[model samples]
Target: MLITLGRRYLRPYAPAIGVLLVLQLLQTLASLYLPSLNADIIDDGVVVGDIGFIWRTGGWMLAVSLGQVACAIGAVVLGARAATSFGRDLRHDLFDAVQTFSAREVGQFGAPSLITRTTNDVQQIQMVLLMGFTIMVMAPIMAVGGVIMALRQDVELSALLLVVVPVLAVVMGLLLWRMLPYFRAMQGRIDAINGVLREQITGLRVVRAFVREQREIERFGEANTALFETSLGAGKLMALAFPAVMLVMNASSVAVLWFGAQQIDRGAMQVGSLTAFLSYLMQILMAVMMSTMMVMMVPRAAVAANRVVAVLDTQSSVVEPTTPVPLASVNDGDGPRGVLRFDDVEFRYPGADEPVLAGVAFEAVPGTVTAVIGSTGAGKTTLLGLVPRLFDATGGTVSVDGVDVRSFAQADLASLMGLVPQKAFLFSGTIASNLRYGRPDATDDELWAALEIAQARDFVEELADGLEAPVTQGGTTFSGGQRQRLAIARAVVRRPRIYLFDDSFSALDYATDARLRAALAPRTADATVLVVAQRVATIRDADQILVLEHGRIVGRGTHAELLASNATYQEIVTSQMSLEEAA
Candidate 1:
């Protein structure tokens, strides 16, 4: 998985990586040449007391040193660019893939995990590339060159490398292997912490109202502690790894010097040769250390890569049409553009015991309001979701204008409807910016008109910035009623063929709800309107009303007809109002 992701995302940066490798090669070669020059300067120039030879040799050494530094700097710069570009492309692809996901897929991984995979996981991969660029490419070159140079000085001294290199590799491999599980655990813990924190922050109001701050705090602490434990476990292994490498490195250096002294004493090697051999040995060990540092990051990065690849690979359950029916010219199919129908529509979440919706059937046509009223968990939201293909019907077809929704391109299907979700959301922006989301090219006058119909213009007009007011993320600055109205205004601005309100008016007071509905009546007169509501009064005057129980339509009639005949309708109505009010 790791190699696959690296290959795929790094494809575009091949040229940059090639240049970086060249730089590292030049730098390592220059670094390897320096010790040989020093040995020559010592053995021939100093031993024979030749100042000119030393000067020329020293000048060459200085030039080589400068070239090495320049190459290293260039290599690091190129590597950074390639790694960051890889991250940018990967993140963009992940976001686009996620955007195509239906609600079912989003729920499958959960939002917190997806967020971590995109940000933290991608960062891990980037870090590995950064370190590998600086170290991994050069390490092998330096180590091999050092061995060859050391053997030129004395083959006997180079023998220490056989023992040292293998030892460091084994120690680092074991330590990293043991630490892999902890890194994996740490990522899971991070997701848990993120989930808990998000839940607490989003539901802070509910938590405080129920006086569960302490309990929430304890929950967060538990998640935090779990993360700490995993991080510490990985940290301990990392801590052990370095000292173990240093031990092998120090032992090898001691063994080289002790053995090289015997060679010098026996007249088999000069002092300059011993000095150069020692330099080469350190270079070889240091190369091993550098490679070890890069390897330390690999296991974590590999795990992260797996997670990211999984997201990219899993296709969305609501697949797009292979040959999409173009909605633009196909709007005249069998009925008016806004007509919607459900035929034995059913939805069951993966692994659930029973379906959320079963054998549900209904139709809404242009120029009329169709209201769905039901108890909590009666699949009101799920039923509305089917029209938008938020979740495709597991058992039947949902059609718009007599064409199956799956047959049309997702974007084309979405263009025919304006959906105001149960939980109204607004991006952080001005009133004008939020309203323009419905139709980006809408005129200011069109925006104000939509706001007026949605009963949101008065409050917006009173604000100091009016249409340019600074809205926070999720429209958190506004009251619930204000947010709902803004969301409705956004939908109104679209003037789409169908308007879907999934209990969007639940936040408004009776007067505001009534006024908003009244104003919207004419504007949406030629469009199909679907309202899913909990309050009995909210849908009482609908042209047609359906009362749902356990995903089935228990009653279908006008308010008076359902009130007089449907037992479930009567129970719901009398629960919310007096018998006289119910009339």
Candidate 2:
């Protein structure tokens, strides 16, 4: 998985990677050459009393050392650039893929897990890539070159490498195998911790209201401890690796000295040669150690890479059309430009036995209001979601103007409708920034106009900074009623052909709701409007009202018509108000 991810995203930085490899090669060669030069200096310059040879050899050694430093620095710089670029591209791809997802896909991979994959998982792969480009590329070159050079110093001494190398490899390999499962568990635990933290933070108000702070703290601590345990398990295995490598390395040194002493005393080797041979052996073992470190990172990186790749590979359930029908082309002398229709539409969530909506059909024409009223769990919000393609209908079609929504480009569908979701979510920005989200070019005067219609301009104008006031994430800084009004104002500013308000007035008082709707009517007179509401009074004056029960439309007519004819509609109205108020 790690290799696959690297190959895909790193392919674009091939030239940088090539240069990095070359720099590593040059640096490793210089490092290997130095040990040989030291042997020459000791054997000929020192022993033979040749000062000129010493000076000349020292100069060459200094030059080689400088070149080695230059190459090493160059390799590190290029490696960083390549690795960071790979991370950037991978993160971008993950975010883009997520944006294409329907609600089903987003729910499949919970938000915390998706966040981990995009951030921490991508970071793991990036760190490994950086280490690979720096230390990994040089390890084999140093190992092979050291072996050849060690042989040049003393062939018999080189035999010790056979046992020492294999033993280190076996020990490190076993440790790596043991650590793999722990690394995988650690990633999952991180997701758990993130989930708990996010849930607690977002619902802090609820926690305080219920006085469950201590319980929530314990829950977070339990998740934190689980992550710690998994990390500690991996850390212990990693701790065992270095000591084992050092044991072999120290034992190899003893063997070299023990055997080399015999060769030197018997006139079979020079003192300088024995010394140089040991240096080469240490270089070989060091190279092996470097490679082992990289191997240790592989298992974890591979797990993380698999997670990132999973997100990139999973296609969204709501697929876009290959050849989208243009918005202008779809009008085709339709009933109205903003007309929306649902033809026998039905929707069922994945793995669910019963449908959320069945045999549902309705239409909202331009210059008219269509209101959907239902008891809780009657699929009011779900029905609204289908029109915007948040989830496609399982059977039948949803069309805007005369075109099926699936055939229309996603941007085109979005551009034609202004959706104020049931939950009024706002990004972290100034008031003007959030309001202008739908229409970036809207002027301050236009913004005030929309806010006035939404009954939000009074409070906004009274604020110290008015339009420039700061709004925190999710609009938590504002009261629920304020957030709802701001969201409505934002939608109104877009001036879209069609408007979707999914229980948008639930937070407002009866007076405010009535006033806002009265002001909104004339402003949206030429546009289509769809309102999903639980409150009977909220939709009582609509040109058309549809009462839903058990995912099916049980009644359809004006408030007076439904009151006269439909029992379900009458039941809901009486539950919310007295017969006098209903009249």
Choose the strongest candidate by lDDT.
2
Q: What does candidate 1 score in Cα RMSD to the true structure?
A: 1.6
**lDDT tens per residue, model 2, 302-400:** 889989889999988787999999877766564568899999999998789999999999889989999999889999999999988988999999988
lDDT of 1 by residue, 36-149 (tens): 899999999999999999999999999999999999899989999999998999999999999999999998899999999999999999899888888889899998899999
Weakest 10 consecutive residues, lDDT, candidate 1?
328-337
lDDT, model 1, position 331: 65
Model 2 residue 377 CA deviation in Å:
2.1
Clashes of each: 0, 0
Badly placed stretches (over 4 Å) of model 2 are 332-335
RMSD of 2: 1.4
